[model samples]
Target: MDNEILLRLYSIYQKELYLYLYSLCGERQQAEDLLHETFLKALLALPGGHTNMRAWLYMVARNLFYNQRKKKSREILMGEQEYLSEKQTDKDLLEKILEEEKRRELYRAIRKLEQKKQEIILMQYFSGMSQKEIAAVLHITPENVRVLAYRAKKELKKNMEEFQKKSAGREDTK
Candidate 1:
């Protein structure tokens, strides 16, 4: 495979691959390593050609992440509970804290989802992959992707509602 062609492929898919891996692994360094490793593997394998290069790349990356997880035997998502207590203006600090809290809550809810549903949601929303692209990667019909997405969204909504109720009850107790 020509280096030029490999570079072109990298430029096209690098950002998406990195974001997708990060969403799956939830670690920036691991995601970067996986992105590089995925492209290296692609470079070696691209001579075979592919009917759907983007989907192929996504599958390769996903497989690599899963393999790494299996080898590690245990993977723990890094938590964001250690934000520095820096001095800042009251309003700015308050707003930042609120935003981070909301993001944390959403991530917690996502983590509660089944693995496949989480993959669909992260691929579609976090990595900006189209449903058709996801269908290709997952080897499923586009209609199936839509159906899964609908069900996943419903479940996520229910989980978030439960979280809110629990939070409200906690506040009442306090």
Candidate 2:
């Protein structure tokens, strides 16, 4: 691929890849540096069978993160995140709080999953990548990706159910 093609690819995938790297490294500056390194590697070494540019880019970013982490032994854990919306009435406020709690519980459960399962869930659900694309990025079979997704979802369901039950018991006491 030429530099022009690489630039287009970078432009298209830059933000998504940056967020992905940030989620992995949990540092904005490190994520940005990794992103630059990812694109630079892509420019220098375009692999064969690279019809899936998005998947290829993700794979490159993930590899760069691994390499950098190995050198530094620094994996920053992300703090709790609360997604906020515009101002709202009391009813909307309650609903928003409930929604935020659910999101937090879900992410907490996702963090409990095995690394591969977590990767599959995030790439497919959060990042909007297709099963085939995820397979390409993870270097696994599409069927494997599908199976892992199913298992991950099942685990997440179980976790949420258990969490809700505990929450209900606590509320009952109050």
Model 1 residue 75 distance off true place after TM-score fit, in angstroms: 2.6
**TM-score of the candidate numbered 1?**
0.90
Q: In angstroms, how far off is 16's CA in candidate 1?
A: 1.9
lDDT of 2 by residue, 55-137 (tens): 88899999888888889886557545665666678898898888888888887898889989988998887688999999998
lDDT of each: 0.86, 0.87
Clashes per model (N, Cα, C within 3 A):
0, 0
Best by TM-score: 1
**Candidate 2 runs further than 4 Å off:** 79-93
Question: How much lDDT does candidate 1 score?
Answer: 0.86
Cα error, residue 50 of model 1, in Å, equals 2.0
**Over the stretch 1-174, how does candidate 1's per-residue lDDT look in tens digits?**
788878999999999899889888878899999999999998887646577788889999999999999999886484446465667788978898877877888888888888888889989998888899899888899999999999999988998899889989999999
Model 1, position 39, has a per-residue lDDT of 92
- Evaluate model 2: give its lDDT: 0.87
Which ten contiguous residues of candidate 2 have the minimum total lDDT? Answer: 75-84
